[model samples]
Target: MNDADAQMIARRVREELARRRLSRQALADMARVSISTLEKALSGRRAFTLATVIRLEQALGVPLQKIPAASPADPLVASPDNLGAYSQNAVRWLEGRYLTLRPSFGTPGDIFAYVTIIQWDAEQGCLVFSEAERLDSSFSQSGKVSLPHLSGHIYLVTNVEGQYRLAVLGRPTIQGALYGILTTLMVGHGSQLIPAAAPFVMLRLKAETEIAFGRIEANHPDYVRYRAELDLVTSDGFAHFPK
Candidate 1:
């Protein structure tokens, strides 16, 4: 951290402590940082490490410092240094429309299908996704993609204010199919929304291949093929879920 960052963080920490009526020891315990280390940093005896700052931010539930803008050398790459720094060229292959499939929440033996378009948003300088061809159009999603190298998985994260919905997908297969798990809220009976999770797959849109979207029930000609694709999610080790 630079001098400016250190000063801002120290001021924010002190302000938070006073506002929350929390003692220094309480904050140290909450952030899991040693008292001596936090004391030294606060007193300007030593600089705070990046890890320490991250922990403090998490504990405070607020960002104490500014996230540096993208570097000039890689100006168009994703920013804030947390989304794996994937450049447009590196993720170019992922830019396209996908036939998204998952289990239906209202129908026990049926599937839900939709079209998801992933494309580079030049204005935002990052990849983004938006859904189409959904029966429940209002609930259709749009979000940012996170490709973290730590797990070699792709995360489609949609955050509305503080509410978040996520899809954690494995790397694409030889045929460019992405299998994963989707976590979101399902509108249940009587207009109730409940937390829901299910296996998900995104098949690359191909020329000459026909795909039907929304509420694909058994006996729909595409049912067998789609069912087999959903089965591959676990059989192929794309994602795992406890029963």
Candidate 2:
């Protein structure tokens, strides 16, 4: 890779590590490499080989290509026209219904699969999503949009409650599935917002027929079936999805 590309990769790696709250030693173990080797790569003292890159990608639950390249300018702080362009691009890619795989609160080894609908909010100039079945409910919801940066485009989403659940969505893979890391700002011991992060993925469910949304509850049989079809992976296995 060129120097610019190498720098970009380093930035992406550091960001991913921070987002997932992974220690260098932990990532080295997961990647089956020594901590020193990983450090050298990160520090640009050693170039990353294809094999090493693949291993790191697998370990981090992120594709190397999904990590954006460094940008020449800050996209979010640009002119109104530039911002509009970024928002439009984001809306086009993200405005749709998705079956989200969320960590199940009651079951430690399972995921909660539910339908969510994303619509464009003209006033907000961003895309908003809510539980497809519970459109009128008071539960917190998330919105997503495209943000421009040196690396091209990044998708950011947030759900507001007492704090916020923010996630950065990666590029879709060959199977059209999306994966990314989630971080939440929560009230801590001192009534301050502390951030915690985890990885997640969302798969698009075929919408040939209208889906029944609001009727499915946590204890419902359909909910059980949905969970059954979804293969629950450990936090480190966030990027893996069953076809």
Candidate 3:
């Protein structure tokens, strides 16, 4: 979205919040967001979330459909296994490891998320690495330096603590492609992917390559079974949905 669009959305939210005599804190509480997050939305520093927008609309009895926000139907989802080959290569490079892949999840706003895990093998005594670096290498080979088709920026969570403390890394790319990947994944899964309802997935690895385990809630079903296999068949070992 452009600056003007963001400004309009923020103004609408602020106006509605004020018309309802709802304090910023109250509105944030109702929307289940941090006060700072609400501030960012109101200040036009960040795009309003789908849930937050809906809540604001309902709270003020306004019609959100009239807004110029990006449509949820804007095809952004993509195959979860599109990156399967790259993921496989990373997993193999760090051989002495037990690995797990998660299923892809799609959200209403055309966002897709998936996760994988790598565990150190007791016999190898080596640290296993499966990070964005490997994925970038693969993308370079495919002649695509960035994956904007997946989303403007992909957020990676490095650590989590009781849902309150989490370390996240955001990688920016082409918004259209990112949205396409997310939308396609949702089509393949036929499910609503929301952070509130369905939490984002994350890969688990051991500190110092000790050992790791994949969480059941963090993986896609197809990924665990045939992700690597599917990667082998993707056109040139990479799937380009945006193109």
Candidate 4:
């Protein structure tokens, strides 16, 4: 995530904790997280994971989706003559949705989350989700990245002109498959498909641009497929559907 977006999430998390009159200790206890870990999450010192975000939401009884994100890059500020490389206009776009499900393989278990991007929507004359990627059984040691854990999934999204571009990040996995499906679906009838692979979640699009940002659906179709598979792995109340 960009600094602008990271800061926004951090501020939102802090505000919610305060609004509910929840002290750091109470929050950590309620979320089953350590105080220091909660501090990093709330301060944006660490990458915001869906696992931690959900815990906070449940504790605060609020949704992370409600958090306000910075608007797409501003044109006037994007020109090299007017701004530096670190400006908002130079930042990329990426939206993530995390779902915590039951343990399927190991002691640490797995944390599920879908990472999606804004692919150009030709028919709609804008950008829409090309796909929602999934990390079904990715393990997170002790529910933190400080120790042994998986990279999960990562990709890029860019806002060029009035449209946002999608960049599938490398090789095929459930994540890439989802993006591929979304790219095809969003451009179903008439649309230009520009398939590019980017390193990390960085957008190399032009400076100033705006696009509607977000995933097309609350739970993408692949999620449904994952749920069916998960049912056989974990019994009863362990598995869940996003609400």
- How does residue 183 of candidate 3 score in lDDT? 16
After superposition, candidate 3 runs with Cα above 4 Å error: 65-243
**Candidates' TM-scores?**
0.68, 0.45, 0.26, 0.27
Expressed as tens digits, the lDDT of each residue in 64-174 for candidate 4 is: 443334355523222122111122211222222222222222222232433333333323322234323334223111100010002212223334454544333321222
The 0-to-1 C-alpha lDDT of every candidate, in the order given, reads 0.82, 0.56, 0.35, 0.37
Task: Please report the candidate that would top TM-score against the real structure.
Answer: 1
Worst 10 residues of 1 by lDDT: 72-81
TM-score attained by model 4? 0.27
Q: Tens-digit lDDT track for model 2 on 178-239?
A: 66655665446776766655455566768685443433456665666544434332333434
Tens digits of lDDT, candidate 3, 156-211: 22222332211111221111111111111122434543242222222333446532
Q: For each candidate, how many residue pairs have backbone atoms clashing (under 3 Å)?
A: 0, 3, 26, 1
lDDT string, candidate 1, 1-243, tens digits: 798889889998888788767788878876789999999999888998988887776455445657456666655644234666665555666789999999998889899999999998876777899999999999999999887644657889899998899999986764678899999988877888899999999999987887799899999999999999999998888778877
**Clash pairs detected, candidate 2:** 71-150, 133-213, 133-214
Worst 10 residues of 2 by lDDT: 75-84
Total clashes for model 2:
3
Residue pairs in collision within model 4: 130-182
> What's the C-alpha lDDT at position 59 in model 2?
54
Model 3, backbone clash pairs (residues 3+ apart or across chains), number: 26
* Position 103, candidate 1: lDDT: 97
